[model samples]
Target: MKYLKTRFQWIRWAVHIGALLPLVVLIVDALSNHLTFNPIQAATQRTGDTAIILLGLSLACSPISTYLNWKDAVRLRRTLGLYTFIYAAIHLWLFVGADYGYQFNYIVPEFLQKYYLWVGLPAFIILLALAATSFRGAMRWLGKRWKRLHRLIYLGAILAMLHLALVIKGDALRLSGDAWKPLLAGIIIGTLLILRVPRLRRALLSLRHKPVAPAAVQLASPPAESTLVKN
Candidate 1:
C-alpha cells in the first residue's frame, strides 16, 4: 500500500512535468531562434517522432513489466498513451498551421486529392479520436467499445508510415529511393505487435502453467490427512 501510494504520487508529478516540459522546450527554442532548420518541418518531425516514441513506449510497458516481473511499470501506460496523443495533436497542428499555411481552401482539397494526404490525414483523425477518449471517464463511458476503438492504433501506425514513405518519395531519391528508415521502423513496431498473437500467447501461458516437482507441489499443496498429526 505504501509503495502504491508513493507510485501514485510519482505518477501525478511525472504527468504534470512531462506534459509541461515539451511545451517549455518548444517555446524556448522558438524564442531563442534555435529553431534553426526549417521550423515547420523540424517542429512537425519532432512532434511526430515524439508521438511514435510514446506510442512505442506505451506498447512496450506491458511486455516489459511482464518480463521484468514487476507490476509497477504497468501504471505508466495511460500516461504514456496520453502523451502520445498530445504529441500527435501537436504534429497535426504543425502540419496544418505551418505546413498548410492554414488555408482551408487549398488545404482541404489537397488533403482530399493527394495520396499522401489521404494516408496521413486519416491517421491524424484516428489519433485525435483516441486521444479525446483516453480518459478514465471516457473509458467508463465507452465500456467495451473503448478497447475496440483503440485497436485503431495499429492502423494509425501503418497509415503514418505510408504517409512518411510517400513524403520521402517526393524528395530527392537516390537509386535506392531511401526507403529503409520508415520501413525498418514499421517492421520493428509491427514485430512488437505480432508478439501478441493468440497462439503464441497460449503457448506462453502453457509454459507458465508447467507443473512443479512433486516435492515443491507437496510443499505448496495441503498434505493428506494421513500425513497430518492430530497433536
Candidate 2:
C-alpha cells in the first residue's frame, strides 16, 4: 500500500507536468511563428484541441481508474477537469474577444449564423456549471447531488466532439492529420460512455475494491491432539 501511495504521488506530479506541456508548446510556437501565417486560427485550433483532449481525459478518469483498479486516479480528476475548463475559457475568449473584437451584440447573431457555435455553446455551459461546483465547499454543500451534477460531463463530452466534427473539414476516412482528429475524439468519448453504464460501473467498481487473497501462513496441524480446544 505504501509503495502504491508513493507511485501515485509521482504519477500525480507527472500528470501535472504533462497537462501543462500543451500550454508550453503553444507559447513557444506563438513566439517562434511556428503556428504559421494565421496565428489566430492555429492558436484557436490548438487551444480547442487541448481543451477537448483534457476534457476527455478528465471524463475518462473514473472509468480508467475503475477499469485499471487505480483508485488513486480520482485525486487527479478534479485538477484535470479544472484545466479543461481553463483551456475552454481561453478557447472561447479567443473566438469572442480576439476573433470578434469583443462585440457582445455579435455573439448571438453569430451563433445563429453558425451551427458549430450552437453545439459548442451548450458544451461550454456545461463546462462552466461543472467548474463552478468543483471546489471542496461546493462538494460539501451539494453532497450526494454533487455526483449527479458532475454527470453532465458526459453530455458535455458528446457535444464537444460534435462541435469538433462539425468544424473539421475533409472526409472522415482520410489519412490526413486534421481529418482524423474528430473521429479519434469521438471514439474516445463513445468508449467512456459505454464504460459509464450502470451495470458496467457497478462491475468495475466492485472489481476495483475487491480484496486480494491473503498469503498462506505456515503452521503445524495438530487437530487430533488438540481436540479439546473448544470443549
* Top TM-score prediction, candidate number: 2
Model 2 — which ten-residue stretch has the worst lDDT?
Answer: 212-221
The candidate that achieves the highest lDDT relative to the unseen native structure: 2
Candidate 2 runs further than 4 Å off? 1-4, 173-177, 202-231
> Which stretches of model 1 miss by more than 4 angstroms?
1-22, 169-180, 212-231
Quote the lDDT for 145 in model 1. Answer: 99
Please write out the lDDT profile of model 2 over residues 147-189, one tens digit for every residue. Answer: 9999898889988998998788766766465768888898887
List, in order, the clash count of every candidate structure. Answer: 0, 0
Sequence-dependent TM-score of model 2: 0.82
Model 1, 1-231: lDDT tens per residue? 447556876766876687658777887897888777677787776677667767777777676565444566678777887787788888888987878878899888877788978888898888789888988899999999999998887788778777767765433344256466566667767775776677876676555565657776657755552233211
Model 2, C-alpha of 207: deviation from truth (Å): 9.2
Residue pairs that clash (backbone atoms under 3 angstroms), model 1: none
- What does candidate 1 score on TM? 0.74
